[model samples]
Target: MTDAAARGLWITLEGGDGAGKTTQAGLLESWLRERGREVVRTREPGGTEVGTLIRDIVLHHRGDVAPRAEALLYAADRAHHVATLVRPALARGQVVVQDRYLDSSVAYQGAGRVLDAAEVRELSLWATEGALPDLTVLLDLDPAAARARLDAADKPFDRLEAEREEFHVRVREAFRALADAEPQRFLVLDASRPAADLAAAVRERVTALL
Candidate 1:
């Protein structure tokens, strides 16, 4: 990033599977762009080439991988993404919005996957070189409702989607617990609402940040 390039706001959306983060990330990116904010919307696992490869192994591996392995893989992807895309973009004053992040690893792999949160955070720091989001918008919703929506939408279940109902419930609660612990950094929202309403809520929160 040069002096002339813009600085960036790194905003990440965190939530359980089927929580509509992908849709919301897209909508938020468009809103930021419309307001003349340079934006780069991306996701974990497949942002950069290296990260993409890691994502495939983590997401589509034939056999089950350990929780630590899964957490490290996500951290690897995050490291590449931040070094290649996120950090530079933020340095240039772009709004680097992303779907999923280290929090997912901590909640899903650590708490949900039964890995230690302390270890997960340490690994994430190594992977991302300790880059933290300016704000984390956690789309809070019941795991049952999220699964129901995914089933209703007729989307194929991914590996994470294949977890037990109780697993997802723990993951969602972990996210809520994280937000509670870091109220200043989190904007927890009810993800059960209609899309338009959810989007509106997200925009309002982000607008204040801007």
Candidate 2:
């Protein structure tokens, strides 16, 4: 395969909060680096300086934000993130491991917030120029267990995280549905498993891509 074909492996980790995506992402980054691969690790709504500001407003804002506006905020951040951070890094043949992507918007804004899923996805696709991850790791978990993990963290919940259990349930279901729709691009795993096991599974799948 040519360099362009062999490199620029865009990978994303998606799931509800407290599903251990951050931990697994760290482990995946370290593993890739150990093998002499260039890895760019980032998160949605806060990957770049501009995105960080958006993250605060979207996640930490006290007042209610209209569902459509919230979705737009996420799309704006995604547009900037892909244009500035993700695309450039991938052009240099780096592995872009992202915490969240358009899938989150579709699940959270579409299903949880009762917006149109197709419309939300279409907006993100337009914003990001239809750049899809080569692989998406979905860490599936029960909302109750996810909430328990978050509660143990002892930190204040963010706007989306503060939503009711029913909302999170819808989000989880939407994630699973998305993964099922595109099995070729997604590896759905039970987040209730041991972190090491989850990391191993992620590594195994990613190694094949590498």
Candidate 3:
């Protein structure tokens, strides 16, 4: 295939805050590198230097950010990140394993914040020029269990994570709905599974793509 036709694969990890996305991302990156593939590991809202500033305001600000404003901030970060970092790396045929994507916005802002999911997704699509991942691995977990994991980590909660259990429940349901609506694009897995097993499943699907 021509370079344009064989553009680099994009993989995104989606789940609640304590669903082990970071661990899986690290394992996936290591596995891809071991196979001699150039991998670009990144996360939304902080993937670019500009995005870092946005991330701070969105996640760390001690003020109430309107739902629409929060969504716009995330979109702005996405636009810059895709334009400057993600697109260039993909053009060089590098595998991008990202921590989150538009899906997170839909789940967090749309469902968690009680905004319109479709409108949120459309805004993101417009911002990123309709960019979508080749694969989206959804780590399904109970919000309570996820909260327990977060507690065990002993880290302060971010804006989204600091929300109520009901909000997290809504976010989880939104993620499941999105995955259901696009079975071909999503691989839904129980996050309670062993890390090795989860990694293996991810590798299996990625192997097929490679």
Clashing pairs for model 2 are: none
Count backbone overlaps in model 1.
5
Q: How far in Å is the alpha carbon of 132 misplaced in model 2?
A: 0.2
Model 1: lDDT equals: 0.85
Residues 37-83 of candidate 3 have per-residue lDDT tens digits of 99999999899999999999999999999999999999999999998
lDDT of 1 by residue, 63-107 (tens): 998877788788878888889999888887788889988889888
Against the true structure, candidate 3 has what lDDT? Answer: 0.94
The TM-score that candidate 3 achieves is 0.97
User: Stretches of candidate 3 above 4 Å error?
Assistant: 1-5
Tell me which residue pairs clash in candidate 3: none
Q: Please state the error at residue 71 of candidate 1 in Å.
A: 1.3
lDDT of 2 by residue, 1-210 (tens): 124355588889999999999999999999999999888999998999999999999999999999999999999999999999998998888989899999999999999999999999999999998889989999999999999999999999999899999999999999999999999899999999999999999999987887
List residue ranges in candidate 1 displaced over 4 A. Answer: 1-6
List the global CA lDDT of all models: 0.85, 0.94, 0.94
